[model samples]
Target: MMNIMRNSKHPVRTAAKEASHERIVSAAARAIRRSGYDGTGVADIMKEAGLTHGAFYAHFASREAMLAEAAERACTESAAIAAEAAASVPREQALTYMLHAYLSRENLEQVERGCPLAALGSETARQTPEVRRANTRYIKEMVDLVARQSPDWGQAGAHERALVTVATMVGTLLLARVVDEPALSDSLREAALKHLPIA
Candidate 1:
């Protein structure tokens, strides 16, 4: 039955389905970041992608499946920014540049376009295993990327420090986003920059 369905799909139909799936995943990524995984709904995602609610099942088996894909998509973009920053700057200053970018006021305000680790970290505790697994993998990817760029890459405690750096950055942003006052928010970000090992 599976083979029959695969063989019956025309090339054009396959391409169109792939395109729709991409659209749904992209929309879910942004929506989940902005509104959260629990807050985002299939109806809203489909509508945001300019498709009907009924079309969701055609693209995804379940909400959790879509959430897993969305988490992976968001985390991939987050990792890319860190990796690129690490590559672009001088070895000694690579982490500094990445830290500055990660803790920037602009990044803090642009949650929908920013790191999934910060945006969805707390929420993932209540998520499915697949979603949690994807988040964990991407987080490790970001940590490894930063660790490799460290001056003491292979030395003892280098990876631990890298993990702390990533955690501090993400935690600071998450705290900054939750505060009611703008002053407190700015202070949180500044404190993270001042105290974090971004030298």
Candidate 2:
């Protein structure tokens, strides 16, 4: 005799599994924001999600897998910010606003909850090949997002602008962290902001 299987209930189960997977990814995002990829261990991520370390493999092949996903999430969030910055009333104004927002004191103090470049950009190049690949894609997407918003600009213009934006934002944050001085930090951030192509 042959048996028939039901797939309706199966869909619901699949949804539940997907929800759990998202939960794990989100937990990793939060932990990574605070401790960064290398500093955040699987046990801590699972604990943050109120889960067990043993259960992690059910969602990811390894900690590296989790970092890859979390890194993408973090970078994706920054890309969204870039897109929004580009969407401001005037295209040129958008880039300038993004420049200011990205290098602000608020963003600098919250390293984990900030741009992956600012949080882990300098180190990402040294991670596993998979991580480096993921970071590269993340960066290109961010540049594309910024470019998409300012069509009044050409590809060369957009490319140069994106490079400048990323470089300034990354440099400002690193300096702020290294000097760890509020006055110097705020001034450096303003100096970067002052150089934007705001109109």
Model 1 lDDT-worst window of ten: 148-157
Model 1 spans with C-alpha error above 4 angstroms: 1-9
Q: Which RMSD does model 1 reach against the true structure?
A: 3.4
Question: Against the unseen true structure, what C-alpha lDDT does each candidate score?
Answer: 0.87, 0.74
The total of clashing pairs for model 2 equals: 1
Q: What TM-score does candidate 2 get on C-alpha atoms?
A: 0.85
Q: Please, what is the TM-score per model? A: 0.92, 0.85
RMSD per model, one decimal: 3.4, 2.8
